[model samples]
Target: MLDFTKSSAPAFQNLTPAQFAEGRQQPGAVLLDVRRPDEFAAGHLPGAFNLDVTASDFGPRVAALDKTRPTYVYCRSGARSASAAGQLATAGFAQVANLLGGVLDWPGALTTK
Candidate 1:
């Protein structure tokens, strides 16, 4: 098992969809979808960007992200995002958060485009 408490960033902090909605309104905030490209194409949050953790380049992909900003990550349930969040933390991302229930509990306010 992973020792999230030892990390520089918090682990498993739950963020509601509304919180994610608000984050999108803030400067330097990014919503990161850790789902696969196909799942993302099927449906995702309006402004969320897809970066699959299963890919071999996941680390480099996240490394390309702005480490100075907060990133909101989510997956199908909560598993993948947790992993991705940990990676981000290890990669020196300052602030990171994860959606509690993924898109399964997004409350229908989410839209895909």
Candidate 2:
């Protein structure tokens, strides 16, 4: 479990694209794409679920996730996922990892749906 109380603010691990990819493969890990619906529809990491950080229900939506499981978050650039990761940590998520450079720097193949 992560020690979210150690600092004034919650901290989330920032993983490189390759590292993020490996983490995504872990059993029961959730790959969350905190991008807008349009952006998510264009292209996203395989198996990533769309959860727009800008949505009005962002907090509620995030709260609905399984906090015990590890969550891997990403966005167009890194900003949104960073914010989302912090939010998840604040929400008592045990494990949270943010993609360092987001999809822009992701080396893995993306899926459009």
Candidate 3:
């Protein structure tokens, strides 16, 4: 059991691409994209919800997500979402993780459909 409370928040899980893909398919997992509006509109994983961490209401917006579920966070290049993941932890989310390199390292294609 990982003591997420005692362990450092925002610590990279550094998942393999395959593991990431699998995680995405799991039930009760949320994909959180913390990129800016423009960047998110450009490209992002299918089904990932945009929360735009830079927005003033980021904390409240993220609070709407299911805290009991695991949240997989990403940004354009892995920076912003790492911070968001930490914030999620502090806000009482138990299972949260940051995509190691964000969407920049994702090998899959993006779609707006």
Candidate 4:
């Protein structure tokens, strides 16, 4: 769970499953599944880009994305994507959001493609 009272709260948004689902439908949404490739292959959010947060090229890969766009990230759970969201915020991303509870909380939102 995210502490909305924290100073970092303004740095990015921590969205609940419902909010995540709604927000992701907006135009120019950039959803990133920050999980390992194998995990991503099993299932992931439709249209999400799989980028392992633990990989050596993670920074460079994310760097190529448009920082001004609204970026939403998640993992199996919320942990790893929280780290990735922090990195994105620090990298000057104008709009960053993390999917609270991640994909585990959205059983109906995943697709195995």
lDDT of 1 at 84: 89
- Error in Å for residue 89 of model 1: 0.7
Checking candidate 2 for backbone clashes, the offending pairs are: none
Q: Candidate 3 residues 4-78, lDDT tens each?
A: 568564343545556777876779889888988888888889998899999999988878878888788889787
C-alpha lDDT of all candidate models, in order:
0.82, 0.93, 0.81, 0.90
TM-score of each: 0.83, 0.92, 0.84, 0.89
Stretches off by above 4 angstroms in model 2 are 1-6
Candidate 4 achieves a global lDDT of 0.90
lDDT of 2 by residue, 65-108 (tens): 89999999999999999999999999999999999989999987
Query: Which is the winner by lDDT between candidate 3 and candidate 4?
Result: 4
Q: Evaluated with TM-score, which candidate comes out highest? A: 2
lDDT score at residue 58, model 1, on the 0-100 scale = 95
Worst 10 residues of 3 by lDDT: 7-16
lDDT ranking from best to worst?
2, 4, 1, 3
Global fold similarity of model 1 (TM-score)? 0.83
- Model 1, span 44-97: residue lDDT tens: 887889999999999988888899888889988878898888888888888888
**Candidate that would win on lDDT:** 2
List where candidate 1 sits over 4 angstroms from the true fold.
1-12, 109-112
